[model samples]
Target: MTVHDVTAPDQERDREALMPEAVIDDEMIASMQARAGVNLRIDHSVNNEEATRIAVTKFAGGIGDINPLWTDADRGRASDYGAPVAPPSFVMACFSGIQFGWPGLGSFHCATQARFHQPVYWGDTIAATCTYEGFTGPKPSSFAGRTVTDHFLNTYTNQRGEVVAEINWQVMNFERASARGRSKRDDKKQDLTLPHPWTPEEIERVEMRVLSEKPRGDNPRYWEDVEVGDGLDLLTKGPIGLTDEVAFIAGGGTPIPRLKAHAASLVDYAAHPAWSFRDPVLGSSEPIYAVHYNQAAANAMGVAFQYDVGFQRQCWQVQLLTHWMGDSGWIIDCDAQYRGFVYLSDVVELGGEVLEKVVLDSGEHAVKVKTHARNQRGADVMPGHATIALPTREGASPVTLRARS
Candidate 1:
C-alpha cells in the first residue's frame, strides 16, 4: 500500500493526453453559454426499495454511520417512517449521478451547497433531473491555469411530486497544461505516505464496532436537553478500496433505481463508441466521466493517485448529523468543502461537535455542528458544517426544511 499503488496508473496515462482538451478560450466559453438551460440529466423515474436499502447501507458503511434507520428494514419499519430512510445525502450520490465530462477534457467536482427538503423513504418512487445553470469564470483558480465554474441545478421529486431535495453544485473545468505545469513545479509535495497495513486483530476490532452501531431512531433528541458541546456517536468507516468505489458507482445514476441507468449508459456507449474511451488493457470502454475513480483518468488529471470520489466524503458528513438527530430530525442546510486528496488505501476518521443550539424566531429549535474528516496522517481532507432541526419536549416544532405533500 505505498504511493506506487496509487501512482502506477497515472504513469501509464502520462504517455498520452486524455480527451476533451477544451482549453479556456472564447469558443469554448461561448459553447458553454449556449448550452446553459439545457438539461444535463434527462427526467426519469426510479423505484427499487431493496436497492435503496443496500445502496444506503454501503454508502453508510463507507462513512461508518450504519444507522439501522438507514440500513435495517425491520428496525426502520418499527420506527416512525414505517420503512428505512435514505441518508439526506443520498441525493448527492445521485447528483455525482451520471457525470458527463467536457469532451476530451477533465472535470472536477469541487463543492456543493445542498438543502434537504424531505426524507426519501424506502418504497417511495423518485423522479430526478438536472440542468446546466451556466458558466461563471475565467476567474482566478489555483487548481486550473484559468478556470471557469460550471453550475448545475438538480431536483428530486417523489411519486407524489413532493420535492425531495434541490441542489446547486459547482464544478471547475480547466486547461490541463497549466495544471500539470503547476503540479510539477510546486516544491512542496503531497504526502502520500503509506500507513502500516491493518493487522488481523486491528481489522476485527474495527469491524466489531461497526456491527455494534445503534441508531437513536424514535427517541427524540430534544433541543432543550442538548448542550453546546455535546458529542455525537462515532461511526468509524473504511480502509476503503476499489471494490467499495466500484460498488458505489454501480448503484446507478439513471432515474430508474440500482444498476439500470449505469448499465444502460454502458450499452449506449457500446452501440455508440463515440461516447466512450476504449481501454486496451482493461479491454473495454468507459464513459468520459470515469476519471472520478479510474487511476488512468486520475493520472491524466495530474493527480498522484486515484482518489475518493467527492460524494463518498460529502455524504459521510450528512450521515453524521442524521445519526445524531434521529429519524425525527431534519437537515436544514449543509455546506461541504473538499480541500485535498484522499487517495486509495486512505482511511478517513471523522468527528463533530455542536457549535451552537438556539431557537429560531419562528420557534423552531436547531443546532449547528462543525465536522471534520482527516486521513490516517491526521491531515484534514474534508471539512463541513450542517444545521439540523431537533424535536422538542417543550413542544416547540422542529424547523421546516421541506414543504411538500
Candidate 2:
C-alpha cells in the first residue's frame, strides 16, 4: 500500500483549536507536586492478568519479535526457566502505569529504565501499581522552555507477591503552543503528507533481513565468548502500518482509550476534557492518545505526522538484547530513551554492540551493550544500553536479577 493509505489527508487547523490554552504555571506545577507519593489508579486495560501462552505470543507478535524463548512453548519448556516465559518488557502489558502531564500541555514519554527481578512465567498472574514520584525541571528544552520532567515509579508483581519488574518512567510536559513554535519540521513546508516511497528492492532488503532474524536459542552466549566490539544481528520492524499500531493496542501497550462511542466517550471527555483534543478532520473531540495514530491529532501536537508510541519502540529496543542473549541469559536492566519521532510507514532497524564485560562482585558474569533503533531514513530514534547476565564458560551460576534496592 502507498503512504497515502496510512496517513491522514492534509488539512490545517486554526492555532487556537490545535492546542489547549493551558500554560505550565506555578499553580499547575504545585498541583502536580501535591500528588507525589500517592498511588494513582491505572487507567488502561490490563491485556494479560495471567501470562498465558497466548498473551505472551500476542505481545511477541505485536512487536514483530520471533524469539523462540517467547514464542515457542516447547523451547521455553526445555530451557532453564522450566516453562514458557514472557518477554522481560511484557510487564508493560500488565499495568496502566501513570505519567503526569499537565491537562492542557503536550506530554512526551522521554525515557524508561527497568530492572527485571524475575520472569513472568506462563501461569503467573501479574498485577501492578504506580506512584507519582513528582517532577524535576522547568528546565532548558528544545521543545518548550517551560518543560518539566515528571517521574513515575511502577511496580509489577506476580501472584506470589514477588516483584517482577520496577520501571522508572519519565515524561516531559510542555506547552503545546510553545512546542509548535519551536518545532523543527514544519508540516506545511515538508513533504510529510505521504510516507517515504519505497522501491521493491528496498522493501525486499528489509523483508529479507526481518525473515532472517533468529534467537540464539540453546546456544548460550557465554560471557567469556563475547568481546567488547561484538556486534549483534540486526532486527527490522515496520514500514509501520496502522495494523501494527492496532496489534500493539490489542496487546495493551497504551493507556489511551480509542473509539468508545456516544455517551461513554462523552463522559470520558467531560470528566477529563484536557485529555481530549478537537480533531481537525472529524471536527470532534479525540483522546490525547490519538496523536499516535491520528494525523490531525498529531499535527495538533506539533509533530510533522502521526508517529509510533515511545513505549512500543522502546520495547523493540530491549527485544534486540533478548534475541541476542539466548534463553539462558537474563536481562538485568535496560535504559531506553525515545529521541526521534518515527512516523507512519517508517522502517526501524534495531541493532547493538557489546560495550563492556565484567564479573559482578557476586561472581555473576554480565555484559553491557549499547543499543539503538534507527528508522529507514537512518535517524537514531531510540538509543539505550542494557546490562545482561549470561552463564559463564567455567559454569558459574546465572545471576539472579533483582529490582534496585
Candidate 3:
C-alpha cells in the first residue's frame, strides 16, 4: 500500500492535505465542524481561445459530448457566445473536494446542485472558493452502511469578482468491506428484475446519435415556443468498457503511476490522490486509481465490477440538456442525484422532456427539463433536471441573473 507521491511539495497550500491521515469518526466530525466557513481560494486562468477550447474539449470528451460549439473553431465563433464558451458544468473543474478527510471509506457523490449566473468566456480568470456547509453523519444505508454525509458549497467568480456559479454538493462515506456483501446481493437481485439484453444493432443506433449530435448549435430554441411534452433524442454511450473508463480518467486527470507529472499541474487546485493501496488483482505496481480498472478493488468498494464515476454521469446530464436547449440557451441551474451503480459494460441511455415552461418576472423565457440516465436494464441510475433560459424571437436573451451587488 505504498504508492509513490509524485507531486512536488509546495503545490498549492494543502488545505485538505491532512486527509486520510485518520479514519473519519466522531472526532473527525468535531474537527471539521470547528473549521466550518473556512474558505480555500483557488484560481484558474483561461487566457486564450485555445486554452478554453482545450480545457472544455478535454472535459467534453470525458462525457462523450461532440457539440461543435465546444469542438469546432468556425462553428463555435459563429455561435451566440461569439466564441467557444465552456459548458455550464465546466466550473466543476475549477474547485471540487470536500476538504474533509475520508481515508478508508469509499466516497460517493450523492447530490450535485449548481447555479450559473454568468457565462464563462475565454480570456477570463475564474476564482473559486469552497466552504464547509456542515455535516450529517453516522446514518445507515444499504449502499454505504454506517454512512455520513458532508456538505461543501463552492462559489465561483470571475476576475471582476462577479459571482458566476455556485455548487451545493454532497458526498457520502461508508465502511467499504461492510457494504461489499450487500452490494453484491442487491446487484444480483436487480439484474434479475430487468429483462432483455440490448442487441448490437440497438446499441449501434444510439452510439451513432451520440456521435452525430451537433448541440442544437446556431438554431435557437425560442422559449415561448417549447411544449411541455417535447422529448430529446436518445443520447447513449456504451456497452461500457476499459477504453471508456480510461478515456474518462485521461480527461479527468486522475493519478496514474506514469501520468504523475501530468496530474501535478493542478496540484494547487485539485485534490491529491494519495490512495496508497495497491489493487490485489493488479498486483503491487497498481495504484489506487485502479478502482475503475481492477475488479477486486471494485468489489472491495462495494461493486462487483468496475463502475462509472458519479461525476462523469453528472457531466452526461449536463450534455443531455445542452443538446436539447441549443447554443443560444443558458443552463442556469442543474441538480443530479445518483440512485445506483452503472458498471463497466453497461449501456447508458440519456434523454429528457420539457417538465414545464415559464416566463420569468424579468421577461426571460425558460424551460425546465426532467432528464435521467438509465442502464441497459432500463433502471434509472442517475436522475437529474435542469432549468434553461432561452432566447425569444421577439428579443435577445435578457439578463436574468442580475450583476452581483
Candidate 4:
C-alpha cells in the first residue's frame, strides 16, 4: 500500500511547508498487522480507577446525557442498583485502546462493539488490557485513496478480578493528502459550508424534542411486553456548542500532550512528530486530533470542516439504550457503525426498534434492538444494535458473562 501523495497543487504547496512526514505505507501496515492478536502496552489518556458520582456525571455531561440514573446521586441511591452506575461505555476512561495500528495515517473510528458482564458501581475500580486484533485493507473507499481497517480488543476488569466489560473497536486508516486530492477530483464545487444557521422555528422544534426527552426510569420494561417493531425513546444532541469538543476532552475523552502551551507543546511535537502536526491557522503544533475541532487542521487532514469525534457520537447512541432501559435493566451487548461525518452544529437524533425477543437457556429475558443516529441532513451517520436483559415478571436473574483470563 504505497499511498501516492496527490494533493491539490496550491494546497499541497502550503501544507508541505508545515505538515509532518507521515503516511500509510505498506511497511507500516505490515508491521502493525504482524502484532495482531498480541497483547500490547499502551497508554490511555484517563484511567478512572473508581466510579464516583462526579466521574459519572462528567462523562454523562460530556455526551449531553441528563439522565438522572447517571447524573443524580439521590436518584441513583433510590434506584435498584443502590448507587450511581457509570454508563457502560464509561469504561472508555479506563482504557479506550484506540491508539494502535497505522500510527501516522489519518484515522476514523468506524465501528465499536461492547459486551457488558456486570454493572460498574460507584465504588468499583477498573483495570484494562489491550490487544491488536488485526487489520484488513488497502481497499477501495468512497473517500481517500485506499483504506485499512484495524481491529482492537480491550478487556476491562474490576479490582475483584471480575470481568466487567470487553469492547472491540475498529479504525480505518488512510493517507490524508490522497483524500484531499480525491475530494478535489470528485467535486470541484464542493459546498464548503460553515455552521448551519437554524431558523428560530427550527431551533424551537429541536429544543422542544431535546427538552422533552426522559429516561424510562423506575418503569420496568418487561421483556414479555416488548415486541418486534416497538420503538425506543429518542435521544437528541447538538446544534453542538462551540466548546463541546473541549468539554469532551476535559471529561475524560482522549487527551494529547500537544495541548501543552509554548515550549511544552514544542517538546511534545519534537518528540512525537507522527502524532503531531503544525496548524497553519493557529500557528501552533497540534495533535492529529485537531482535525476533529479545527477547520484548517481538518483541511490538512482531507476533511472539509471540523467533525464530531466518532467515539463521542458512539457514546450518544449508547446513551439512547441506557435511557430506554431502566436502572434494573442491563445492557448485555451494544455495537455501532460510524458511516458518515457529523460536522459541527449537526443535530443527531438517536432511536431504536425492538428486533427480536428471546428467553435464554438460563431463563433470562433478552431483547435485541436495532438503533440508528441520523443527522440534520437525514443521513444515518451511525447505525447500531443492542441486546438488553430485562427483569421478568417471574423474577429472572440478570444477564452475566464469564470472566476472561
User: Candidate 1, after superposition: displacement of residue 155 in Å?
Assistant: 1.3
Per-prediction TM-score: 0.81, 0.90, 0.80, 0.89
Alpha-carbon deviation at 261 in model 4, angstroms = 4.1
lDDT of each: 0.65, 0.78, 0.66, 0.75
lDDT of 4 at 163: 91
Q: In candidate 1, which residue pairs clash?
A: 19-104, 19-105, 20-103, 20-104, 20-105, 21-104
Model 1 per-residue lDDT tens digits across residues 1-405: 243345366765554335445577777777778989898744322323233666767655545555667787887666555566777766655544444435444566777778877778766666667888887877776766678768887787777777878877777777766666665545246534443367888778766866665667667788878898988766555676777677655543321112333578678766545355554356555555455467655655766556776666677777767767887788888877787777766667667789999776766788988888876678778787888888887663452233222
lDDT of 2 by residue, 250-324 (tens): 776775543466787889888777767776556777777877788777767877667888779878877888788
For each of the candidates, give the backbone clash count: 6, 0, 0, 0
Poorly placed runs, candidate 1 (over 4 Å): 1-17, 43-65, 82-84, 93-101, 184-188, 194-214, 253-267, 270-275, 396-405
Candidate 3 lDDT at 395 equals 80
Ranking of models by TM-score: 2, 4, 1, 3
- Ordered by lDDT, highest first, the candidates read 2, 4, 3, 1
- Candidate 4 local lDDT, 324-398, one digit each (tens): 977668888899999878888788899989988988776678899999998887889998998888878778436
- The model with the greatest TM-score is 2
